[model samples]
Target: MKLAIVGGGSTYTPELIDGFARLRDILPIGEIALIDPAEQRLELIAGLARRILARQGSPARVTTSTSVTSGVDGADAVLLQLRIGGQSARHRDETWPLECGCVGQETVGAGGLAKALRTVPVVLDIAEQVRASNPAAWLIDFTNPVGIVTRALQDAGHRAIGLCNVAIGFQRKFAAHLGVEPERIRLEHVGLNHLTWERGVTLLDEPDGESGREVLPELLDRFGERVAQDVRMPLTLLESLGVVPSYYLRYYYQHDAVVRELGARPSRAEEVAALERQLLALYANPSLNTKPELLAQRGGAFYSEAAVQLIAALLGTDGRSRTQVVTTRNDGILPQLPDAAVIEAPATVDAKGVRPLPQRPLPPLFAGLVAHVASYEELAVRAAVAGGRARVFDALLAHPLIGQLDLADQLTDRLIAHNHGYLSWA
Candidate 1:
């Protein structure tokens, strides 16, 4: 069996590669290929992967190419973790739209839509290749605007899964609140990526209804303010529904009433600047190329796939055990909505491949928001690929925040004029 990691030379690639190398023993199978256009990044990462494999007492064949098709053909799986602007370009993508008075945040609002228009085609093209070349390969997505991109790929009939560290990562953060280890927790993650909240977690056998009755009440009463105070957490989903969540809680907190009541806001300007400075510094680091050991210390040397451990679970490596993933539609897994809804839900993994979790209805607000954004993203994908400004305008207007503002037409025009070549139809 073979695995292909498209955009294999990214900063995060080393992490994924290292993660995969770490899990390779359980997997104990075949070659892992890296697909990337930049020879420099690919060479550096390949060197590192071999070194990692050697250290792990295993010899994993590492190969790469500039061509997407060559990298993906006949591969058993493709794990995608692509960035549109690379590290440096993200600053402009994040800051420019905010400067224009658009939602200004990354991966959710105006900025996300703009980024989506630029990315959909590349992702779509690659998906088409993967489907045609190796129809059985699972497409694991770690792409941003994940809900939007994942939805589009499935609508076009590609085999794919969206992975967010959010589910596990969030579980860990909130575990701090509950006083437990994340690995020991079992939870149901619902809603869109990045926006997802834990509807439920069972730890120490915290019976569903029991924890629902006890822990949430305690969280809301005791540490609710503490959780919301960070400005990176999204406690609104928790408070609105009375369940705790993980990942990026602070920003969501600002979006919620609790923050307003407390007169709190995440320092957006400062936050954006700090992120920009960090990314800039990362690009400027010289040891990034010549010194693998030192660069490894920086944590960028671990080129990796999105779900090696999960893949190990599917392959049943080292008894890692299978898991349930909430992603895309295969059948009537979700009862009410079209299998086409691209709803996130629990799934099972095995040596054969990754399969969808049977779907359940999300909370009304969460469902509606995910549906609306996904629908508009599809519309925007069509517009971007076909060069239709009106459709693009309508797509932007259809977004929750943009739709609410009534500035779609003007904002559309301004952004089109400003972004120019960047937004095709605009």
Candidate 2:
């Protein structure tokens, strides 16, 4: 099958290429078209992609293009991993919010709102081009603020499904702790993208004579310190919640502390900017065909596996039928949330498309936070599509992380001032 990566110039492309090489048996990729406006990065990434495929003895051809229409034409699937304004813009997103005494994060709170406003319009334009090129092709989004972006695509009548590696990363970690293969571990991963909790971890292939048991608590107890450290949450909090929260939750649960920490250090965007420079230098090395070890520090662990598995399931390329966690429309899977809201949960995937699995109502603790964030996301989408200063102000006001009216007003003005070039209506 022909697959195109929309932001193929990203440093993360090598990790994805490694997955395509390793999982060739399941997906059988024939061609990979790298689409990006950054020609230098595109050439570097495409070379590494070709080298990785060659090392695997796979015959998939690697091509590069700057035109979305040309690159995605006749492709079976398109993957969106683009950044609107690159790391420089992200640096602004991660820093400016601190002046308002809020956590400076790229995927939540004020910074996340900035990203959504800038990204949604560009993604929608790309989706339109993809539809013009090949209506049958699926758009797999791996962008930040995925829930909002995915809803925008689906609402605009695009065939899209959002993908994140958080669940898979958790599954792999839990599997390692249990001394079992990752496939045997099934996580009851629920909530909006980036904001989720692991309520249960069940063994899919329980050995004979072994009773079915929920392993999340045991896993937490045995490795609570390490888990807490990884997520930057207190061990006591995890124990109290009785559920392992995603690392992103740290921004919400410890907003003030996180703001202090952020203020003391360089923005994550700055760190990544330095890292990307080194990564590009490494990519330029002709001898370097395999994914570099430094790439792991860049995060998105297990992203390739997640993307490949999701695509294989969607295209019915993988012979086995199974359910996998993905980001898609609620469709009653979350009765408490709006039907048009996007959620990340386990869903059965096949040629017919994705079907979210039924989930029991979340407990009040989790439900309240999710509903609060969902409300903000709904308004964020509206502001992104029908841009206006008022819409943006309302979105910030609605966010639980930035709920105060005065702070919202200040943040709204700051966001527009910093991102006016990208926001046409502003």
Candidate 3:
């Protein structure tokens, strides 16, 4: 199979390459096209990718391209992982929001909205090119604000599926804590991307047929504190909610405190910017054939495994359906949101297509939050596709984090000002 990775210049590319090398038996990759405009960084990443494959004795042909059309041509699958305006833009996304007393996170709140506006247009353009090259090829999005991006792709009539590592990361953690294989632990992962909760932990040796021992209570009883620490939530809150919220929930459940903490520290974007520089230096070393340990701290843990599993199932390489967390159309999965709304939930994926499984009614607590965010996402997507200051302000006003008019107005101006170069309407 031929696979193309857009933004192959990113420091995160080697981790993906390592997964491709190790999982060749499951998903035999015959060729790799690394596409990036930054020719220097692209060469560094492609060199390490070739060396990693060579070390594994894999015969996959590695190629490089500075154009999306050339890189994705005739490829069976195209993976989108590009950043429109690199980490410097991310620094702005993470810091500017704190000035208005809001969470400065890239995947949630004001920062997430900024990323969606900047990313959606670029991703849509690339998707159009990928479709033009080979309409049959599947587009896998591993981008930020995945809910919005995936929604835009499906809206544009593109064959796309959104992937995130959060579910896999949770699965691995719960598996290690329970002394089971990660595959055996199926998460009852529900909600939108980056805004999900683990309501049930089912142990199933086979595919999720909606039948398994629900061990969430037991897992909490035995290892609640550790789980709380991992998610940065208080153990008492976990007991009260009777569910595990994504770590991103910290931004919502404790918005003011998070804003204070964000204001005090150098933004995460700053830390990652420095780390990427160091990682690029390492990638440039000809002797380096493996992903460095520091890459682990750079985040996106288990992303490669998640991407491989999703691709394998989608391409029928696994020869059977598998349940995995993905961002796809709601399709009435939750009665609270519109079917067109994109949500991150576990679904059965196979060659035929992805179908969201039926979900139990979300408790009022979770449902309210999910519905609120889903509404904001719809508006945010509209603003992203058809830009306007009023649209931006409306989306911000609808967000639970910035529902006040004054704050929304201020954030909208700042978002537009910081993102004017990318926003065509600005």
Q: Count the backbone clashes (under 3 Å) in each candidate.
A: 27, 0, 0
For 1-426, candidate 3 gives per-residue lDDT tens digits of 899999988999999999998998878999999999999889999999999999988889799999999999989999999788889999999999988998998879899999999999899999999988899999999988888999999989999999998899999999899898887899889999989999999987654455579899999999999999999989999999999999999988988988998899898888999999899899889999989999998999999998988899999997988888999999899998998999989898999989998999999999999999999999999999999999999999999999999999999999999999999989
**How do the residues 1-426 of candidate 1 rate in per-residue lDDT, one tens digit apiece?**
688889887655656656666666556647888999988767767776666666666566889988988899888778877766564344444455454455455475566666677777789889989887888778888787776778778778787777766565545555788886544455676655565566665554542122332254665677777765542444564577666554333334344443243233443434444554454345445444322333343222212322765666554565634554445553555444455656555566666656765445666756675666556766766665666667767887887666744577766665565456665445
Worst 10 residues of 1 by lDDT: 297-306
Give the TM-scores of the predictions, in the order they appear.
0.78, 0.98, 0.98
User: Which stretches of candidate 2 lie above 4 Å from their native place?
Assistant: 206-212
* Model 2 TM-score, 2 decimals: 0.98
How far off is residue 398 in model 3, in Å?
A: 0.7
Candidate lDDT values, in order: 0.62, 0.91, 0.92
**What would the per-residue lDDT of candidate 2 be over residues 101-205, giving only the tens digit for each residue?**
988888899999999999999999999999987999999999988888999999999999999999999889888888988887888999999899998888755
Question: If both were scored by TM-score, which would come out higher, candidate 1 or candidate 3?
Answer: 3
To one decimal, what is the Cα RMSD in angstroms of model 3 from the true structure? 1.2
Instruction: By TM-score, rank the candidates, best first.
Output: 3, 2, 1
Candidate 1 runs further than 4 Å off: 174-181, 204-226, 229-240, 245-306, 313-321, 330-337, 351-367, 404-406, 417-426
